[model samples]
Target: MAFLTNVNPALAAYLNEADPTLWSRVYCPGDRYNIKTSNIAESINSMLMKAKGYTITYLIEFITKKLGRWYWKRREDALSLITTFSRGVEFLLALREHYADMMTVERIDGWRFYARGGQRDCLVDLEAKSCSCGVFDVEKMPCSHAIKAVKSSGWHMSTVVEAYYRKDYVYASYAATIIPNVEHDPIGPNIRCIPPIPKQKPGRQKKYRWLTWLELSRKNGSKPRKSHKQYMLVQNADSLDILNLIV
Candidate 1:
């Protein structure tokens, strides 16, 4: 039960006849608050976790390449229009609005991804930063539900980001890899000696006196009776046949 304000004139005008719940559901705090749906994003995280050991190198490079292709396409489209006809900034700027594309993913209830209303559920009460599933944790960019939560809570995205992840934490991993310079002797570094290897012992130790005598007896004897179950398990028919056929 949260209050809905006509925050934006454009949005308020568009929702003139829409369900107040629909608006809430479509946005945050409300969407995350909804007790009724499944959080689908959890499955994606599970899959990712199962696939485990994913290096950040692959993740960062792959996303950058994808975004780069998108930038190139946008630049190409802009250039194509510019070459097609004479246009000024006023016309170009107006056309820019039409040229831009918006992409969105609608959420499903009862899925792995969780939240409240149609908006992203921010459990400020629980310090959920984003969702429990970590989509917010990795992307840093909030999803629709998160955006909705921030707006409804009257908070800024920066605040939400700060609450969950520190500004310094983003480069924390990279910083660990940085090696600082330490003054060193210019001469070839003195080497440390390896610990001496232990001397090898005799093939048979006194502890196996009976075994040693038995082996000697068998070697001296004309033939020896053998009954070993464990060794037999490793002896296949082909191996047995070879012994019989060749021996």
Candidate 2:
């Protein structure tokens, strides 16, 4: 904050106004389950980069086939998992356990302890499932400090981790199949469909879509507007009228 104030006081002030929980993992009230990135949509867009020039029908078919393959492969992997936790979580816990072995735990109480090791010291609370280092609180998994504390308290590592990291939960996540639609003949007589005429705007074409006001507000570090459900209902009504006219 001192560095921010020195460089850009206005930006620092803006950040101070915003809720830290929304951006800072340390302050987050809920578990992230160790999923760090929030740009899954951008990742999907990157995956579809090659299909950008394809027709809408072909593009959809490509996406469906890709998703179907992913679902099948992931379901097989999930089913093959013999461990209680998912493979990734199991690996993570193992790494943490290795570091935890070096840590010395001092019992503060039945459910609390102070862990000191490798130039780092942290307070661990087994009852609250948290540590001063914040990893256990946000990820819902035992950090090295918490792991040391757990071992000292005669508790299993599995008991410290959240159920979300369990193999069963991971399997359930990929259980849904993405079946592609079968090709079918049109119900009505065949008719030639012409493409709509394109009107070129009097400027350089935009490479990206314009951000919505909500998105803009978030990007600009401003307060977001409340959602307009009534406005959305009116828009839906208008769309229904258009569909009725087409019918």
Candidate 3:
């Protein structure tokens, strides 16, 4: 909040107004897997950069084709997997087990245990499927502490992991087909498409993006040094004299 206040007062006010659970991974319930960015949307936008400047009809067609190809390929791959859980979940569980190996577990009761890993100590309850680390509840997966407790009690990891990460569930998630609209709006009475109205603003539109304080700082720190000769050549290049310019 202090950081936002110093940089952007509006952003600080907006953050204060919005629920913390939406932004903070620790407070956010469900299988977030610790993601905290719009990189996935950004990646898709980058992939469709060319289509962005196209007409709406062409853009829709481009996206439709891309999605259709992606769905079919993923559907085939999902059907081929015979594992009990998805590969990603299995990998995570394996990693948790590796970390859990170093942790010491003490049984408290039938389903409760105290797990100590390095400087951290977490209460693990198998019956309630929870951990003091808050990872189990947030990720809907057994944390390293929970894994240590579960293994010490002679229980299989599968028994503790969420069923949502099962192979069948993962397969079912991508089973839906993306059906394309074969035809546009019917010409006469059924015309549903509307043309966009041209509304140009008075001033020159902004081409550069507004960077946050953190982004600006990162840019400054990681910025590459430019060649002085190249920079001078580009700056001094004559716009009208085309023939004399270096090819």
Candidate 4:
């Protein structure tokens, strides 16, 4: 924030005015599950890249087929899981458990414990499923401190982990089937359907599509180059002046 204020005070002020919960995971009320990007949307776009020019009906059909295949494959994978939690969660828990083995847990009460490991000491509450490190509370999964406390108290790891990471939940998520509608013969008199004619705008149409930030960065071999308009803007201009120039 300090760096942003120094570089662009207007951008910093705008960000400060907005609710941090909308942008910062630290302030978010709901669980983020460690995800911090729009990779899901990017993945969908990648899948439909070749189908960009397809007509509406064909595009829908293509997407349905693709999703159906994904559902079937994922359902099969979920069925094969013998563990209580998903593979990813199980792997993470196992890794944390290894670290927890090195940590020493001192019972503060029936549910609370003080875990000391390496240079850090953390408070772990088994009943609340939280750790002073903040990882357990945010991830909804036991951190190393919590794991040590759980083991010392002879409590099950499953009791501390959220149900969202369970095999049953994963299986249920992919249980639905995507079925396309079957073609039906028209009973009424056939009427010719035609698309409306497109009216040309006053200006000439663009010859090329605009490149995305990722494309631009890749083309430059690092950061994206500033546009001609951006270069024209005065470097030391105030926020109001910058806005007026942009307008």
Candidate 5:
């Protein structure tokens, strides 16, 4: 944030006005491990840019087919996996282990310890799964300090990592098959059928709502949108659709 303020005051001011937790993934609450940016969303939007021109039924069918293929592929991949943690989390754990090699741990008790790494010292509590650096609490993954403490206590690295990173949990996540939408299913006669609205210009249509300052400025629509409605739509659709599309 300080760097941003030095580079561009306008961008920095906008960032400061927004909730810090929303922008900085490190300080974000909950088990939001390995989720930093919306690159996954951007990738999907880029993939489906051409589908935006298709009619509603065609769009639905296209997406449905894509999803079915992905679900089958991922399910097979997950079933074949032999590793404990998922690939991404495993990489993080390995990286933290490397950092832990340089750190020193002093046990204060069975659950708590003091670890010194890089130029700083932090208190680590294995039972609570936390470190004074705040990374362990927020990311639900062991930092260097926590890793040192875990090693000193003769605990496995997996003992400190969150359950969400477990192979069973990851496999269970992608286990379900996606049934494709029924083809040529006619709409009911009593129900009114509405076609999707057309885009006036050529460009990739965004599936997610714009929240950042630059994105707000790039918005092309003239009419004012209700912020609450837009936010709700983004939360609901983005969460469901993107998970199916990318995962």
Candidate 6:
């Protein structure tokens, strides 16, 4: 109950319950620390550097002309693949769904972090919001530990995606195409064809044939049944063993 009170007051009040361990962890910070910073310019710049390597001019011109359509049409049918690939650092930091194991949510002086008794592998999620791990702001994406937090929250990934991707930026290319339809209407009615409807298949023959059981029997023999036989035999004792026993 105490943990709920600190982690999310609304949840505590709504559920009418408190978590002692959470409260204890929140208040106790003898071991554990928070990470600092929120900008990931370096990381983004790295991505930009790699992406810029592609020769833009050499690629198809349509991409620059109709970016939205190009992106939309090219989006893979594999939704799962895209969702996983698109998960950036932010989602991980905010959610912290990755490291659900060792870290516990601890808040000291209103700052939150998933702290371990010592500090190796521990993470903090802070926008000065809540996190002991400070990787969120530094990289502008979820740190590995932050991804653990997100998974713990039970929130939809789609919501995270919407928050990260800007609306105008994602929609701009699709909205630009405005080519109007300008084809002429109908002209005149045409006559139908009547060339015996083209031969669809060979016609069924009317040749006479026998279908009686005897006729079938004469044509083909019935499957034969196997003979039922069983044999049991008892072997005599080996000569060497019997001779030794007798001696």
Leading candidate by lDDT: 4
lDDT of 6 by residue, 145-238 (tens): 5444454555444333324343343344344454322353322123222245565567985688766765566567863244448753436668
The TM-score of predicted model 4 comes to 0.68
Q: Give Cα distance to truth, residue 143, candidate 6, Å.
A: 2.5
Alpha carbon lDDT of each predicted model: 0.42, 0.83, 0.80, 0.85, 0.78, 0.45
**Model 3 ranges with Cα > 4 A deviation:** 1-22, 29-33, 181-247
User: Looking at model 4, which ten-residue stretch has the lowest summed lDDT?
Assistant: 184-193
Give the TM-score comparing model 3 with the true structure, all chains together. 0.61
The residue pairs that clash in candidate 3, if any, are none
What is candidate 2's TM-score against the reference?
0.66
Ranking by lDDT: 4, 2, 3, 5, 6, 1
lDDT of 5 at 60: 70
TM-score of each: 0.23, 0.66, 0.61, 0.68, 0.63, 0.29
TM-score between model 6 and native: 0.29
Consecutive 10-residue window with the lowest summed lDDT within model 2: 185-194
Candidate ordering by TM-score (highest first): 4, 2, 5, 3, 6, 1
Model 4 spans > 4 angstroms off: 1-20, 184-196, 199-247
- Predicted candidate 4: what Cα RMSD to the true structure? 17.0
Model 1 per-residue lDDT tens digits across residues 144-235: 44544444445554554432233233223223232222353222213322366998797965554456555766878844456546534436
Model 4 agreement with the true structure over 152-243: per-residue lDDT tens digits: 99989889999989999998999999986458432222332346799989898879889988798998799666554444545665965877
- Candidate 5 at 95: error in angstroms? 1.8
| Candidate 2, pairs of clashing residues | none
